[model samples]
Target: MKQAPFIAVEGPIGAGKTTLASMLAEELNLPIIKEIVDENPFLAKFYENMDDWSFQLEMFFLCNRYKQLEDTVTQYIDKGNPVISDYHIYKNLIFGERTLNGTKREKYRQIYHVLTDDLPKPNIILYIKANLDTLLTRIEKRGRPFEEGMDTAYLEQLIKDYDDAMASLAIQEPSTVIITIDGNAVDFVENPEHFTEIVSYIKELMK
Candidate 1:
């Protein structure tokens, strides 16, 4: 049988990924998988001393994300339920590249691949691409306490890395549909017309 539609909304931090994903989930009447953030005990300390806390933070996220994806497969995808997710498993790899180094990174990758290798891939990836200023503004508006004094340099590099990874992912997984949306130009949250436009667009694609 043909696979049930799996839509994954992905973007750099503060790009409103969860917002868009939830909206899509509601519009499409699909179950939504949201990422676990801020629950990490090491997150606050990681910001204070990245060298000391990077591995721990990363491991916590890796394990949590793995379990979420695992459940996504057995609980939803395998049973033919269409699903929408705020993140793709590849996010661990993207963040790991920036936070990890040497043997730590190598081992992290080993663990990542082991956990994610069997997980179901998204049939459609809604990639929200926004300018650095736009991302920063949104991040500030959200006012997550953990994000205070965020590193712009790190954010800039992460954006580049995400874009690069998306490019590679498209080439690597030609069967997956990759749709990039300009977050700077579109106000999906406040503009009803824009939101409806996106909803209509994605509905057509789902067929």
Candidate 2:
């Protein structure tokens, strides 16, 4: 039997990672591993005061993501079932580095590396890119209370950080393919043609 592909969708906050992941999963008939964002007790508090709660929030995400990936590998990947994930484990570092600082950041990095060293990496990554204005508008439309007061400067910095992180991943994981999708150009949520285009691209890639 052919090995199943593990695809991950990544982007900064409000970049539609979840939306695109859902679309791909449905179109391709793949099982999805979604992020448990609202379930994190520290998320709302961390967004309110990042300085005080960053470490806690990162740790919470790290543990949960680790568990999810481990379970996914055993239950899905090992069975040769195609898997789609909303966020990749590497995202923990992307957000952690931005949230934590100095000694705290280093400590978190140590823990993250140790925990993730043996986990399976995604075969392909679909990185969604959108302008800040588009992202803010989507965030507003989503109507998440914790995200309503998100700092503009922070979001701008996050976009830069995400770019840097993706670049670094390209270099570090040379074998893994990264596909960039223009979120601003295509409204996958509204336009069927745009969604079909993306699905077609992914099908070609997988083939």
Candidate 3:
């Protein structure tokens, strides 16, 4: 049998990465690897005050994602099981660069490179793109306590960063396929047809 492909769904916050990843995993019969956002102890504090907790929050995410990816390779990839993840490991760097500054940022990069240097890359990345109004609306609908009253300016920058990161990934990793989807075009969570359309897209990509 052919080895199963690893698929990662990525996007700015509230862009539906987790929901899409879950749907794809079920449709494809693949294991899902989700980011442990609620488990981050520093997240609430970081959101309340970014400058004070930026490094700690980013480091926590980096360590957790590293371990998750390591286990993913051992438990799924090595066994030829297709895997779908809500967030790609590189998201740590994307968020880290936005939060950390100067010497701290440089130091974090060194550690990040060392930790991720040998990890297997996802065969395909699905990037969900949305306008700021759509993102804010979705974020409001979700109603996560920590995410309540999130800074609009911060979210604007995050969207830009995600776009830049995806563009960079396209140029840097020519072997990996990256597909950008307009988040506003489909309500995959509420509408079955929308979900089916996305599933069909993934099936075609896998072929």
Candidate 4:
């Protein structure tokens, strides 16, 4: 049976997930769901002192994201409305594992599973993979104050973790379709042809 499209654009920070998600949503006329980032009061301080605020920051995101999916995305998709989202909810765990220490990480994991278990899973994930330097440059250009102090080492690890998570998700959920995009390959933003090509590719896959 042809499945209803529930698309999620996923990758580490600065990988252009939101940009691509917007592009796809516009092309398909789908409702878009973006994560609540700037609204997180702890986000600014969390970046500055990760060790001190990891749990609080994570819990805040978890609650907010849960609300978004529950209130908006799920409601639309249940009525057969296609949905596109910038961030996959699972990234919370990928990040929580890296930032939260032993006990904290374990506790967060329990909470994450409890919350995400019944959440709607994305049937299509656009995994935008970019090189470290490319991501760093994009992050700088975006100029978010909280991201100014982002650690290169942390970003590097996130890149690796995201890739690993995608692979595992593919195996565990065979029904989910993952479309991996090479960020270094094309400037989809600056180049219309490249953007069109990406959209075309996604259309073909969705068919």
**Best by the TM-score measure:** 1
Off by over 4 Å in 3: 1-3
Per-residue lDDT for 25-135 in model 3, tens only?
A: 888888899999999999999989999999999999999999999999999888987789999988988999999999999999999999998988788999999989999
Tell me each candidate's TM-score: 0.97, 0.96, 0.96, 0.95
Q: lDDT for model 2, on a 0 to 1 scale? A: 0.91
**Deviation in angstroms for 55 in model 3?**
0.5
Q: How do the residues 1-207 of candidate 4 rate in per-residue lDDT, one tens digit apiece?
A: 354688889999999988888887888787899998899999988989999999999999999988888876447767777788998888888889989999899999999989888767889898999989999999999999999979899999999999999998999789998988899887889999989988887787667
Q: In model 4, where do residues sit more than 4 Å from their true spots?
A: 1-3
Q: Pull out the clashing pairs in model 4.
A: none
Q: Residue 146 error for model 3, in Å?
A: 0.9
lDDT of 3: 0.91
The positional error of residue 115 in candidate 2, measured at the CA in angstroms, is: 0.8
| lDDT per model vs. reference | 0.90, 0.91, 0.91, 0.88
- Per-residue accuracy of model 1 over 1-207 as CA lDDT, tens digit each: 777888989999999999999988888788999989989999988888888888999999999989998889898889998899999889899999899999999999999988888778898998999989999999999998988888898899989999998998999788999989899998899998888988988888878
Which is superior by lDDT, 2 or 4?
2
State the local distance difference test value for candidate 4: 0.88
Candidate 2 vs candidate 4: the TM-score winner is 2
The TM-score, computed over Cα atoms with residue i paired to residue i, of candidate 3 is: 0.96
Q: What are the RMSDs of all candidates, in order?
A: 0.9, 1.4, 1.5, 1.4
lDDT per residue as tens, model 2, 1-207:
545789999999999999999989988998899999988999889988999999999999999999999999899988887799999899999999999999999999999999999878898999988789989999999999889889999999999998998899999888788988888897889999988888988898788
